[model samples]
Target: MIARWFRLAAVAVASLALLARPAAAQQILRDAETEAFMADMSAPLVQAAGMEPRNVQVLVINDPDINAFVAGGQYVWVHSGLIAAADNMNQVQGVVAHELGHIEGGHVIRYGEGMKEATGITLLSLVLGAAAIAAGGAEAGMGILGMGQQAAMGKFLAFSRAQESSADLAGARYLSKAGVSGKGSLEFFKKLQNQEYRLAIPQDDSYGRTHPLSGERIQVLREVYTVDPAWDKPVDPKLEARFERIKAKLVGFVSEPAQTLLKYPESDRSIPAHYARAYAWHKSAYPDKALAEVDALLAAAPHDPYFLELKGQVLLESGKPADAIPPLREAVQLTNQPLIATLLGHALIATENDANFAEAEKVLRNAIARDRENPFAWYQLGVVYEHRGDLPRAALATAERYSMMGQDQMALRSADAAMQGLKPGTVDYLRAQDIAMVSRAAVEQKRKKK
Candidate 1:
């Protein structure tokens, strides 16, 4: 299941400039298996780009657009729709390679140069137009204004196209250095080309566009890709198999239940099919049916941790937390995935058994130690503290959760409450104070922006 975490951050707009929009809050989909897969896929490309693999992150956005981009940091933001549209893991790797190219090229950082040039042209035009209007030549003034605006747009678009082309070449070089085939890169471009045709997008008019036309990109990249030594190399079969499963999983999770059933009918009993059907059934409120699909999956791959996690999730969400514990516990042990551990901690707390509180606290603390970005884990830990009658630590936990979710005011209040109860200079108290300071800064920043 996709663990949805809402983060208040600006939407990235570096690559796929054609789809650029105003900054807004976006949902990030975090899943242990999917994240691990993306990390594995991007590792080689990140190394080839001369960057630390640990510093580069491939994050999945919950949007349904078939786009991916780099947003001024070592992060590649991939839309869920991109995964669904991809035919293989190599296709996704190709996209990651391109985003890394943008990162290495410092295109986002250099974007200000292009903006500055365009702004200068616009300002010059405004001055010239004002002079013409003062000289009683209104028509000429309007013409000057129109020509200047066109020139400014053209200059900006040209700059954007060049950056895109440079990134494409850089991506090809990285793919070659990493010993990965460029076949998927070319194939994905062909897919985009076909989409252009379907949308009746003009292929010849490239000057006014933010990105080069798909046909033009393919024509230029083909010369480089066809001559690469790894052009014919086969993709990793295991990675490709994982890609198929996640692709189907995303489809089931995002699509309507009826649509998922139609796409993966009962007759299709493969692992990917079962995975998709399980989510569909679960979303449709058919716990028995969902469990049946999960059971089928488990019967085939008895030791698969993800299937076990699915079983645990289905049972837990269906109001049977006790029954969910066994599989979840095993899943947590098999893969110390913080998300799974968080789920297990939630299940333990949900049982309302006082005896379970100690284990829940321990499990949640361990999970948070591994990954502090998870807000739900913090919330579950807070519940454990509350149940144990540790009010100060519970408030501290609430502050942590609210801080992560960008609720600065609520975090401030919770942090203040926690500090009043906690002894000064202790770890928990200091952490609460840190949250209070950070929340104050964030609140002030927002106020200034407004």
Candidate 2:
């Protein structure tokens, strides 16, 4: 039961980069691109909302169509297509402002409420259903709608036009109040209107599925912007560059392998073009070609960890775990990331067998500690613990993971293992009592510590 509907922001590039950095892991340039752009565009609007810039995180989905949404109370998700297609900073700001309107006006919470009433599941369960979908999809690497919730696949996308319109009205006002160009919101909707007509031929909910009925909405935006004049801020070229690079990188990951390989770079006939080709060929499983391409990239920028990490991932995926070792080790030594540590743990388990079990176990434990939110890490930890003959501990870890993930059946199995291992009147049960107390406190603790 994969939920494909929880798409509100760009969640894949960072997740992939975090998972794959063995020899030369590169930070996702796309999310960083969106965040940097949003940071500049959000100033006026956030100032108006009376919120801090750091409290907000802007991310781009690898998706190429126009769309935006908010997750929970933070992190606005914009499609990279929106970034590529935007004419200026004002248009982008308008999109951000619209989503901000949802958060500021509690439209996101409303959607959750509607869905809960519709599906009879808690908000946290909905998020877990989405994460389960993501982990399952990881078998195919990365592509379009990676963050799309598993629940969406179950035909459960629930956002009414009223909610969409409310968000839009609130968005326009937020833009005006924040002194951003409110008129740009109208212009943004107008483009979507034109896109709607162009889409009348196919009619498959390209951008207007949740944000429905663009024609009338476009008029409403126009009226609002005309009446209120907000600051007309100019677009930054650097932001545009980041946007283009994000598309290029996403295209690197999701485009048809052969098609991507055929795209040649005009800037540098040697390095960048080859780097692009390497991505396609390696992902397509042509190891010799990937090796040859990486050799060329290394010749141009020998110390670049990004290229090195890519080459390492290719090697590991190609059934050459030994070949993947040196570069991945080098990458870890360079970055000190728990992400690389986890990848290395996997490599050791798959390739080194029993020889490196001790090392893999230790590294993965550290990785889980650093990022418990990664369900994959928990899954891997269970595997490691099971291998060590600690079946009861393995079951507990897996059950805890499933509990966190909202997979009650799987969690129940794991929890049963730990409970079976327990004695009636002992410190083990007492320790469990302490954990429950802490969890109760966690639910009641609303404010973050300073």
Candidate 3:
């Protein structure tokens, strides 16, 4: 369903929203758990680097091509293929540091903007916003994109030779600052430089097209990692493991299922790769095989809450909803997971009678608490409230959803029903204010952009 259309409207909505603040990275990608794990692992630890993960977000694009690029600000859209092909934490960190270099050196804002303007794509912001959204909810779906829609690619790129050299030099310095040996950066760039000819594009249009790098980049990088060099730091063990896990998982989910299945071995040889393959099998709906794989993972690391959640999902897919409850419950209790709440809510509805409705409500409540803007969660909560004879609550939830979607009349009508016999100072009134505020902010941002 996602691998279709360039949802210009959705992207427009998102790009407009970003004027106010960066949406949660999960918004652009469907897999919330993997992103959360990566976010945690990428958290700032080394104070000497003068960098904070909060300000610089690493996004995984669902593209199979070996590419990664930066937009204005601290966003680095890494192609899923790059993540899969780049083994271990160091390679991933090296790639990310290079991107961080782009951010630190302001290549995205300084060069990307200059090019976008030069190419007559200023209005292209809205169009590209639409394209990004159509690439599969770039606002909220894990930088949802595939190689399929390079259809419109006439090279919306920028960055001169000097800019690339600067980014490379800066990236090397950042590797040292962040306390990750510049080793990863050198190795990764060396491969790209070496394979510049192997790529389908002409030499002139390599990573250099988007981010120019001359001989100086490689020249400096080689010497930077030399023994007793100016400064080189070791990569953290914990951060390295996480990079491998996220990169591998992203690979399976984005790659062709069959192709991914063949390459993704469920083995102790590399636990992260095996886990990613297991996830891909589940996504492709081979639940029995997925369960077998996840069970092996559990045996290897039984305390992993994520593995437990995966088990629950597989059971649900394999027609054993009853068996799914325990593990999912464990996952939620451990992390208060957002997606698990929705899944667990549905599982409860399927297995238990009306008496189990409360469990579903709890899930709905948590989902809403985590993301007030998620329409699906609000609608589910409304349904639960209506089922429980809580007419006002149902009306309020539905009305708020309508208001947020910009259906003002419907929102008003629903609010009228919801606020019946309701006091002015009640919860419904408070919710109404919150809804109106969000709608106002959204509208105001659009107007300002225009």
Candidate 4:
């Protein structure tokens, strides 16, 4: 199962969306398998861009919009819709290449340059308009103000277009350097071109838009890509196979059960089809059907950690936590993935056996140690602490989870509780104090905003 977390971040200009807005809260979808796949896919391109693989992150946003963006760091956020829309892994790699260009070029950091230029134009126009009004030329003042606004907009749009063009070129160069074909990059641009046609977007008027027309992008990229040595190279078969499974899994997870079933009919019987149908069945509350699909998958690849994880999730969510333990335990041992370990810990705690509490505590603590960003693991750890009658530590865990979810008021209260209960000058007491201070500051900031 994919976990969802809320985080506040800025959405950058390197998006396919026509309209732009300020920083906002976004829902991030986290799954061990999807994240691992994205990391693997983007690693080559990240290295080609002269960055450490560990430093660059590819995050999946739980949005249905067909877009990807860099939010002011070495982070590339891809909408789930983009994955559903892609035909193959190479197409997504192409997107990764382009976003890496934005990261490497520091476009997000330089975004202020364009805004400053546009603001200057608008301010100048305002001064001129004021002078005209003072001279009693009211009509001329209004006309000057309107023209100035339009000119300022045009200036910003032009600057944005230049950045987009530069990123495209840089992306092509990175793809070439990585020995990856640009065919997928060109093909994805064509997909955008077709989408523009479908949406009845104006193709000729590039001046008013933030991005260059997809047709223009294709035309420009095609020239560079066609000459690249890797243009005709074939995608890796193993990687393509993984992409297909992930794409199907995402469709099943995000789409309506009926739509998933329709898209991956029972008659198909392939691994990806099985993956899709299993989720569809599970979501529809037919555990038997879902288990049957899982069994079929296990028969095909018994050692696959993800399939085992899915089986465990289905069993656990279906109210059979005891039954879910074996597969989930195996999944944890096989992968040592924090997400899988979190699930296993949940299964242990859900069993309600006091003997299982120690194991659950250990498992949950280990999972949180490796992935401190996982709010769910922290919440589960809180549950374990409460079950063991450790109120102070439980409150601290609650604070940790709430802080990650941006619920600062709740975090502040929990941290306050933990601080009062714990011994002064101890590590946990100090951490509780730190949380309290940070949460109080965040709460005050929210009050000011309101």
TM-scores for every predicted model: 0.93, 0.60, 0.68, 0.94
Candidate that scores best on lDDT: 4
Top model number, TM-score = 4
lDDT values of the candidates? 0.86, 0.61, 0.62, 0.87
Give the Cα RMSD of candidate 2. 14.6
For model 1, how does the per-residue alpha-carbon lDDT over 294-335 read when each residue is reduced to its tens digit? 999999988798899999999999999999999999999999
Error of 1 at 219 (Å): 0.9
> Of the pair 1 and 4, which is ahead by lDDT?
4
Per-residue lDDT over 1-450 for candidate 2, one digit per residue giving the tens place of the 0 to 100 score = 000123332243322101111111212233222344567768667766667877786765656667666657576766656765666666777888777777777765565555544343323344554565577854343332332333332223334455677777877777778766665666777777777677672444424244455666766777777767554544456655444444444565656776775665434455546766776777787899878878887787675555566667788889987777677667656755566666677777778478778877887788777656556667777788888887766766776677666565556555656657766457544443444444445434532433
State which candidate, 2 or 4, has the greater TM-score: 4
Number of the candidate with higher TM-score, 1 or 4: 4
Instruction: In model 1, state the lDDT of residue 184.
Output: 88
Q: Write the per-residue lDDT of candidate 3 for residues 134-207, one digit (tens) a residue.
A: 77767633222222122112233223445566666666666665556666666666666656545454544434
Error of 4 at 24 (Å): 6.6
Clashing pairs in 4: none
True-structure RMSD for candidate 3:
11.1
